[model samples]
Target: MAETKTPTPMFPVVQGGGSLIVAWQIKGKKVVVVGGGEVAAGRILNVLNADALVTVVCPALGLNPEVAYRVAQGQVTHVPRNFEPSDLDGADMVLVAVDDPAASSIIWNLCKERHIPANIADVPPECDFYFGSVHRDGPLQIMVSTNGKGPRLASTIRKFIAKQLPKDAGRAIESIGRLRIKLRQMAPDVEDGPKRMKWMIDVSDAYSWDDIGGLTDDDMDNLLKYYLSGDVPSLNVLKGLPDGKDASDIDLFDGSFGFSVGA
Candidate 1:
């Protein structure tokens, strides 16, 4: 018989070594952005969407058109001077976008001393978090990150994923969220947690995106009533629609879920 040997392991066995991704909530918090160039403009927009109070520390000459417009509109405060150590005061988060490496390093170190999270553009090692390419649709946001490598590639990947989703996916999510709230309010006191979860899963699995999107408030009430009675309602019972349907009826063929490369 020929000698047999075990193959070598192809990957590392370490666990919990990569970045811990999270949807951070920074509403009504202070975010200090250093520099007012194009890079800083992108950061400011992201923080603003999260409802963070932002202050940009940079010379007036450095402000890009977008950043200057924000300052003029009173959307964010512009100090119009070089960064100061006091800029970090009362900051919930910090982001550095200046072209000066030495100045960025100094700011990063200051954030470290204060235990504040920071992101230094183009300097992955100094960054506490890396920004990901994001796709936003109402309350839904999908992000793709390359762990500080090949940012453009990550963006390409995000677009690819978006192309596979249905155009009404976000609308479906909103409708389901409303139904979930109504279900919680109407659940009988005797329904246990597991029972409630099982019925929810069953209902979600039984419906398509278009079906869910087409549901009315009265339909939701009828569906929950059936579930509470130990019945997973069919499409016919809930909306008087055909019960046997598949994903082909969705809007996937329209190309990229209402998103385009230019978008």
Candidate 2:
């Protein structure tokens, strides 16, 4: 018998230098936006979707149609004047999109003094953080960032990634989340935490997106049985489950960019 040796791994060193990506919860938090141009409109919509309480400050004449519409509809509180230093009071975050460099600089400084995270649009040096191009589907979100280097390239990369993902990818994730919840419930003991995690890792390696997509309540019940048995279901068993929406049935790129996804 011949003994086998493990092959050396390629590109082993991990690369560094990038913003710490995280899903910041801003729901019901106050976000002050200074500007009313197209850029400001984009920022407003992004924060609004995150359920942030937004206040838009800029001259009424500065607003473009989109921002004007949002203000008219009362989607956000509109302070129809130049930004005031008092606007930073109780602000959880700030987004500055004003074209006036001097005014933007003032707001950035104020945010710095107050230790509020700020993004001075199109000005990397002044920004506490930069927004990434994002692709969203239901509860799933993928972001591509260039660290304020090339936004257009980030957007293009985002589009390419979106094109490659399954149309029902978000649904698959939701289903997996439900399974995770059930797994936790089944093994709620703190001592079983490691076992539960190991089982999940095994299941992840055993199943494909298509297999997971077709998972029904009955299938999940059957799958969970393996956790106690220390085994995983055979591929034939998973394949026998009912089919989900075919990936080829929908065109993911048809209207992908119809709306902006993130800030």
Candidate 3:
């Protein structure tokens, strides 16, 4: 007797109303784009953003002029040569576009044999995963992946979600980056990573409401002194350090670097 087949789930169809999420490191790695049209554009365009070395292989090609210009400018390398299954050798990632099921299958198999991750456009299962729309805000980049269900809708949602973030987010990330250096220098004697990390987190979290201008260099200096002194120091010793915020909250005794030069 023959067994009955069950219908596959329509998760991408149902839930892909707007967005999805994933994280990866693709910079300076080797990636191959196999195809010519807009399908290939979707892959090559983004790979360049990460500084990944990319090669687009297509025997017959139709590229938007800007992409062609970038190729000529050496921003991206393009190969007008035909793609063979073996062309995928030594790739960190492969994106297949030819729109030919047989060709896609051949390349997918080769990628599998070589232990490389690949994405097959317009065909989800054949791919490791499909591309999702991206909404970027400084260190806060949000991507919506629908398992490749509805890319148009995903991008649409990304546009709206992007508006929900503040333009100052990038500036804030930059500010945090600046603060970290000052933090490490200010508290040179604090030997614990957890403590240091906690300090960073607390300062950032505190930014949710308080005007962060309260965190000045002088305060940082006092806080470090209080933490490292290990003995009771006066309350006035640290200038910018937030009171009762962490282990550095209380004054220690007999500290060389107390709240004041007098202390």
Candidate 4:
């Protein structure tokens, strides 16, 4: 009989880098999570919130009754079993939250082999990616990450950071995003980062536009064109646009940019 040697644990692996991030609609799609612990429940909750059809596969779950009730209620599907390689088939997304490293490693290998993206809890060595600790208020979601270095520390800081966010922060970020797009279309030549940031600040802070109240959508179009093209005919131009009239119209309160994600 031949003796087997243990392989090396590949720690501190770089999972993802410098990639463009955006939210996607996942309603009625398949998302599989493996585990019965609080961590697994958390991942499932997030997936459910995103409107994805979620499936949980675990032999035993130490979760709340509500979650199990959801399974029984047919809102979410639960499979009472340990994982197998065949579980990877047709799985849009996979989450491995099991405590067994060997089982997690197998699931990760299956996902890799099948070209499915997988997130493994506390098992970065076998993870394709990770979900950040999230802080969401209405339209604002702040995500913080440490690139998988110190997850607990990163999450703790994010919690503290979230405590400091104002109620209208999400709306403000959305407003800025819309304004930036308008500027790009209206003033393609002068559309740079600094100018866009300046325009956002000006519109959100020192100046306010309140003339687009009764204006047609076409008028709003022209308004954005003018601002981005350096044709600031009037400070009142914003009023002639849509959804541009209120303290809640913009969410520039939070200084967080590119810091809204996973640790």
Score candidate 4 by TM-score against the native: 0.60
Regarding lDDT, does 1 or 4 come out ahead? 1
What TM-score would candidate 2 get against the native?
0.78
TM-score ranking, high to low? 1, 2, 3, 4
Listed in order, each prediction's TM-score against the native is 0.81, 0.78, 0.69, 0.60
Q: Whose lDDT is greatest here?
A: 1
- Residue 10, candidate 3: Cα error in Å is 29
Q: Write the per-residue lDDT of candidate 4 for residues 96-191, one digit (tens) a residue.
A: 887788878888888888888898888766666667778886556777766677879879989999878754666555555565677676557753
Q: Please report, in order, the local distance difference test score of every candidate based on alpha carbons.
A: 0.85, 0.85, 0.68, 0.68
C-alpha RMSD by candidate, in order: 10.1, 12.5, 9.8, 14.2
lDDT of 1 by residue, 88-201 (tens): 999999999999999999999999999999999999999999999998877789989888998999999999998998888888888889887887777755546677788778
Instruction: List candidate 2 segments past 4 Å from native.
Output: 1-17, 235-263
Off by over 4 Å in 4: 1-28, 60-63, 174-263
lDDT of 3 by residue, 78-143 (tens): 777877766776689998887689889888888988999998888877888677788665556677
- For model 1, the stretches where C-alpha displacement exceeds 4 angstroms are 1-17, 188-191, 240-263
lDDT of 2 by residue, 78-101 (tens): 999988899999999999998889
RMSD of 4: 14.2
